[model samples]
Target chain A: MTLCTFIKAGLLGGILLAAAPLQADDLEIYGFMQVSGSSQTWDEDYGASLEADGALVGTWIDHAQQANAIAGSEMFPWQGLVGLKDNTRNDISFNLQQLNVILKKRFNRQWSSFVNFEVVENYKTDYAQESEWGSFSVQEAFVRYAPSARWTFKFGKFVPTFGNFYEIYNRTPLQPYLFRPLIFEKSVGGILPPEDYLPNTMAAQVSGTLRTGIGKLDYALFLGNSEESYFAENGRNDTDAKCIGGRFGIRRGLFKAGVSGSYDYDRLDALDLGNDVVLAIDYKVPRMRYGVDFSGSAGPVSFVCEGIFVVYDLDSDQQAVVDASHAAGTSADNTLDKSFFYAHLQYDAAKWFVYGDYDFVNDGIQPWGKDGVNALIGGGGIRLTDSITWKFQVAQYSYEVSVPHPLFGAPDPLAALGGDLTPVNAPAAGVYKGTILDVQTGISIAF
Target chain B: MKYTLTLLVLALIALRATAGVSVIAHPDVDAGSVDKITLADIYSLDLLALGDSDLIVFDLSDADPVREGFYAAIGKEHDKMKKLWLRAKLTGSGEPPTAVASLEEMAREVAATPGGIGYVDSASVPKGVKVLATFE
Candidate 1:
């Protein structure tokens, strides 16, 4: 009856019909599971508001992170495991921190269809009213078609091909932390929904492989609605927002280099909010049976910093939608712009790796005035098998702004008292700071 | 010495008849599934090249003796199986051979399907199926 249900039914029917002869023996099945523990510490208290003292205020402390102090240490179970193959029974699985399914059917030799699905935790209702098992969301549903030896066309709701980590699984070899870069989290166009599902926003894409003089070349082009859209008699359209992008990469000897870029136009609902553009590049070399990946990028920054040095631009147009959705009737501040930049380095050998990351983000104001989340993270991993891995990490963080309480107003007494008692000028009205010890292990199997 | 040479010549002539591979089959079946099958006939088969059977319908998996024989006898026309799979996965055109779990399953699958052909241990040959050749 619902949109989601209709989509699921249609896809399922398509697969069954395609498997008419029904060779159960032709299917392959695979999957994995994982568990972990983590601890967190904040630089400020739960509501780290500004004190009477100004310069001496900002500090880390809290059960939750706000503008005042740093919050630290939270732990839980994480999934990890993967199966490399299967053909006896038609099934495909991927182990992320979540259980993902890859459903595919081989229609003869030249054509086949595939669908990738992920489960998302919906924290919409009262946690108490919900079942402990958690709810699920279909992160991706699409079909891929390769009609030639080096070219392919795909249609459906799939992650756009914009960033290296967006389409590729396994972050140990690409990013520095288990979490994404700050720029990735707060940036406008880079932080796609189903955060961990894929990269860029959902859209249609065309990509392919080509033989070069020395090795090979890979490229892709994608088109999608920007961060905002207007629903009309004809369905959805960019109206004022749209995202168009592409990625190019080349392989030579033991090295690979790539570049990605995208332009976003955001509006919809008759409001001229703003826009965004992003450019990124990365290079990698494999030696000693392992390798190193180095990456960096910059754009019209408006994203919030999850850690130091990392940055991303906010999709002003999309933010405007949420802002409009909750207009005067609610307490919501629609962020219009953001500035971001960062660099990361990682070394991966077989199943083991080590990494480091940094970020810096400012939204529509002086970098320091707009409270920032500056952090340094380091970590490592141990491969239990070809499909499972264990991870360990630590982070050091600092905050720039403070949250003034309801009573304090401007130039509060807390500022006069001196040491560590200033107001934090940030998107969230509170002070924040913290340390965290993250220990987790998981496996991934695919078939 | 002359008598001994004459005796050796007689023995050698007797060996040639049995030296070639035993291209066996079900007496009722007209086509041969052997090391040296006809190119036109080979192409017609919906064949399963087991382990290393050198079913050069399109290409060879490896460049070895059986493969060499197939190409040598058929002329240079086919491609390698490895290249074909890579091409299919990358280009989205054709698919590579399905990797089956065992010879028994391969035989059953091939036998049940028309135009199907695959390899199995000589001892396991079923009644409906026929042995095309013995490589050894």
Candidate 2:
């Protein structure tokens, strides 16, 4: 069935269940809401030069100006290549981050069902501006059966067990930071995309826990449709391959650790031919991701750490094709390997909390000639009441573009104008440095 | 001497106010007593069934001192417990225990429900319920 149809059917089922007369012990309705406002300031220095045959053609700041002009414009296809201007500017916005509702019913000791509906950024379907429209979706709808204490099975759509934070990150009231770590921030349009690093949802899952002598051992296995592009026509696998993953961990008292991995096929519709031109090339490459995560607490201080590695395996034929495109003036080196890491520390008291975390991502594609991006974030929160919390955060980001691409010569069309004319075979290696300072404040309420 | 006697009486009253709590269950429950680990598992919604019957757990409001003492005895913090319950409820694994306003209500609910469990002050051990464990 189509996703829209499935959502409508799920909502109808939930409404019908709510209308029925059931005991208080059988049905439950709960949810939470979060709203926030944020401001960002940028400071960047793009001291790049164009040269021909080892001689300087021109030294201009126009590159930085052009980058700034298309900072947030998705319509500009070359925005990714030039990167953002990161120039001295300030941007502010207020958003209803999320309003989530959950309906659950217990049919018996062995069977139960759950449904979660979410409205984010005040979602409007007909709005013209992207910022004016949000999203409304059914995050999860699943039925669970537990025949014994050590075995439980689930079917439907739900987030697979991966990492320590992916499953609970959206529960804002439970999180210490208004802005989660980069890997877990689904709403943040960061350089590192979480979908590339982890599996977000699965069709079926089997999970259980064992009470061992030392601690409790937990394990989960899940299956789902293969990964698809963000703009895929439908949320179905394009190939016969499916995504499979699992996580295993142990918990004792307040400390727990887990290892998780997934295997799938990624469908890519476009290929980067080195320069600013976007080429459509359809290919399904084998992808594998693995990660480790651990969390623990000592009195009032709690900390969590996680790291993920992704590898895209291309056959020799595909490699040769990529090489041919690069030799034909596209850029030869094309790699899709990526790695990410983050560490978070928080001190929670009776009525308040303070936290700090660091995030790093290395994109092997190097769309902007940058090796990686690093972010250092700090924040704190106050518990206004049992169900209400107010939080604020400050984050600093550094985009490291330490190397210059050989294929990135000044556009021939621009050079023909003669304003800063340069018939350059190759551009001189230049450093591109950019940074952003972001501040945010928000409140979350749980009911 | 009179002042010392009055101070002694006040201390006794304070001791009674901070008395220990007892983990009580319906007489139909099979288990006679539960260890600290088992208690934690059950109250956290990690363990849904005890023996052959499905467990029906009840809780007192957060403002109750007996509720705090019960969690401390199980080696869990209030905030952490709330998070655990939220995760359980959202994931469809389990639901949070039904909460009653006072100890008297807790006793009454557990007595009327099958496979029921709750906690209350040890000094006020009401009738019609079986004390599974007591913590000081």
Candidate 3:
């Protein structure tokens, strides 16, 4: 229906459903603002060796991937945005951003449904290009049913139910810095085209939390077709992937630890040709507790860290295809056996908090190899009001690789491909470093 | 002095006895049939409050204490259910049950309504109506 018709219909329903006057129930209005500035370093020799790494080297085949190269590219230096929030007594909320509109509703006390539409913009950077950046599309739409207070069953499009930063820390109210983790920002393939990391894929997921005698157990069962075929005319196929995994953790008082993993099968016609699987473990504990003499006393200081390992199972045919593409001087074969680790410490007292995180991603399986990525991020914030906060942070990312490709003179293939037409199989590696200084603040309130 | 004191005490007791309220009921109802009513039960039962202008319905021929017993169990000092109904109505939520002036009126009206919930003197209960609970 048209926007006008939709609005009219809601108003008509409101009149007919009017109930007891709302006097005792509380109502409030809230939202937030965030602004950040970042500086990055590229391989001093980023024009070559696009074949050295899977994340960058494989981009040579997909034209869209070639555009994401940041080396030999101009930097934005600074970016910011303001978002609005609206919540009602019945547990419903609305957030509108550019072409995207999000709505959430809680049914009775156990179930809820949410829908988010994002408009793509038409813009291109060496790193990626979003075709419909300024256009509208459903970013996340799903229904969540919670049988108890701690578990949920969600079916629809949502962020992958994995990784710490991918879930909770990504929210504006909780994040320590304006930018996401570097491994996520730089290496992970987006679920969407161009720079769309963790693309909007359609799937049905059953996830819940369990309280056992030992501690707590959480699991997720997911099944869905490749994001590319989700919206197609005939979307369901045997080739569709299935995922099942669970996280086991123990929490006694202020300390908690858990491990989570998932298995993925890549196929075109139900014939599974390759697989991608990942396992991760995370732990958090209160490291210190101290009080100051002033009325504003500091609370407990905590430490959190996690490690993730990804194993690739490639079939002979897949290996042959990459070999053939490489012989033609066009394919950028980038694949790696590696693990990513991150550790951070956070101290929160009253409305003020400070944190420091170190992230590491190895490009290959060799010990002390000359190929890897490491980053350090530090930031802190103070709450100015119940719905508003301000933060400042600094970050740095560096890459280590030995080989250099000839085409783009960088360590990766996107540089070799030169522009949007770069082959997906090229490889490039080099040490690039820079510091990010960002100051951001925002407000959020619910009614 | 002791004789005079005893005589004075007897006079005071006589006066107090005459001043106390009297409970009335329909002639057919068994006056001593029921036991005590709980606070929770009374709330769920949705009993009505009695006032000077209110018209209560009951058969006068039964010997049951339905009317007198219920009458005694109501008011600010007894049943809280009456107040809850009034509060619900004032808040624009629940509607209070209707009042009838006679047993005949009550039976004829309540028998036709769906989920018909009403109260009458135990002695005045009609053929179709069911007696859920009562108090002495």
Candidate 4:
């Protein structure tokens, strides 16, 4: 939709959806500002530079969607899951990020309903702006049934049941950095991209806290439509099989730990040489992902460490096709097993706070040797007030394999094909190896 | 004169440092002296039931000297506690303790409402509310 349509749609939705009007005192207005001046070297060696004009304003369809986009691919995993080319080099300015309107009111002693109406600007640094559902999407609209203090049930569209990062820190005000770690992102690749990381899903979930000997235990159970898909089933997938995912956590001493994961099954038609070498046929891609996270706080220091792994399983026909492609010197791993990991350590003293994070991925989405990113980021923030901070940060990304043909430098055969050109046999050059520096100063506020 | 000023300053610091915390509840509440863990849970909105009675939490204003003493006694900082409440509000968890302007107001509300629990400085403890715990 155009910018005009987006504004009108949001207004209409806001008016129509104000049924049980929240009491003025019941409504909480919270949002954050990300004012930053950044200079990025997409590849310093090539002198490829992009300047941030200092201010970014984006909230195209949902809260933080563009912020999520502008975070960019620390290591872009896939190229064409949705049949669109992602031009990241031109995406330089994305700020003025998120505004969240949360209405939570208790209906009775037993029930309360929560609704979040989020508005975002869908603008690109480049010349294309597109949104499937205009520029207004419900971040979360749900009702909670709290039978007791320890147990609760939710029904409606809400944050997808996935990881702590998405549920907790995905908000602009909450995130210490502008971009998210690659593990929480769904990139392009595999027979079909898994419907794992879509920001929100319509679901029914039950969660609660338990007083167990193993610290205080918390658990969540979710079953929903694994929407984001390329297969025939879009917005809802694998009718025969639904996505089952949740998290289990417990706090012990000064530390809190949890394990969470999801599984999705999908089917698609594969075009291939089929012995006679003519057409691509049909196959199924069933994928599973799991992760473990631990966080702790001591004195003025707090830290979190998380590791996630996703594996895509191929059936006999798919394996046969991969074998055929391999025999023909096309590069496709037998059964895609990808791993991603990130760890964060942070410390705070008086008015200043500092942090360091490491992100690594063995995505197997790209060609061999070019399949991972080891990035270390360190930064600090000075608190100007309880709600505002000034932060400066630097990030350095180290590629597992050196790219023979750097981005925008030489024409790379595989890079040209993108992820849409499957099998990725031409052995595309890996990520450009060099000193890629991203330096930014931000004024952040949350209320 | 300098010596007198220093003594005055020390006395004010001492007064701020030693504000006694009174964890107050409704007179109808049947709970006994709450342990440190239970107090933490109540303030964090994690523990809602005290025996047969369900409890709601309230707080003196963030800038209240008594509130600062209460948080410190529980081994928490005011800013950190506020952030925790912010997360709770955002994540569909329980809401934060409603802030009242003064300890007398907090104590009075706790005393009148069934299951209402709150903290105040001992100096402002009003009638009808029972002191469930104290941090000296």
Top candidate on TM-score is 2
Q: What is the model-wide C-alpha lDDT for candidate 4?
A: 0.61
Question: Candidate 2, which segments miss by more than 4 Å at Cα?
Answer: A1-27, A47-86, A123-130, A230-235, A271-282, A320-334, A368-370, A402-431, B1-14
Clash total of candidate 4:
14
Off by over 4 Å in 1: A1-34, A49-96, A121-135, A169-177, A183-200, A228-240, A267-351, A359-372, A402-447, B1-136
Candidate 4 true-interface contact recovery: 0.33
- lDDT of prediction 2: 0.73
Question: Per-residue alpha-carbon lDDT of model 4 for A41-135, expressed as tens digits?
Answer: 54323222221222222211111232243345344344432111212232255444344556677766557777776544333243444532224
Better candidate by lDDT, 1 or 2: 2
User: What is the alpha-carbon lDDT for the whole of candidate 3?
Assistant: 0.39
Per-residue accuracy of model 1 over A234-256 as CA lDDT, tens digit each: 75762544566677776553345
**TM, chain A, every candidate:** 0.56, 0.77, 0.58, 0.70
> Taking the candidates in order, what DockQ does each have?
0.05, 0.53, 0.02, 0.51
Q: List the pairs of residues colliding in candidate 2.
A: none
Q: Which 10-residue span in candidate 2 chain A carries the lowest summed lDDT? A: A78-87
Taking chain A of candidate 2, what TM-score results? 0.77
TM-score of 3: 0.47
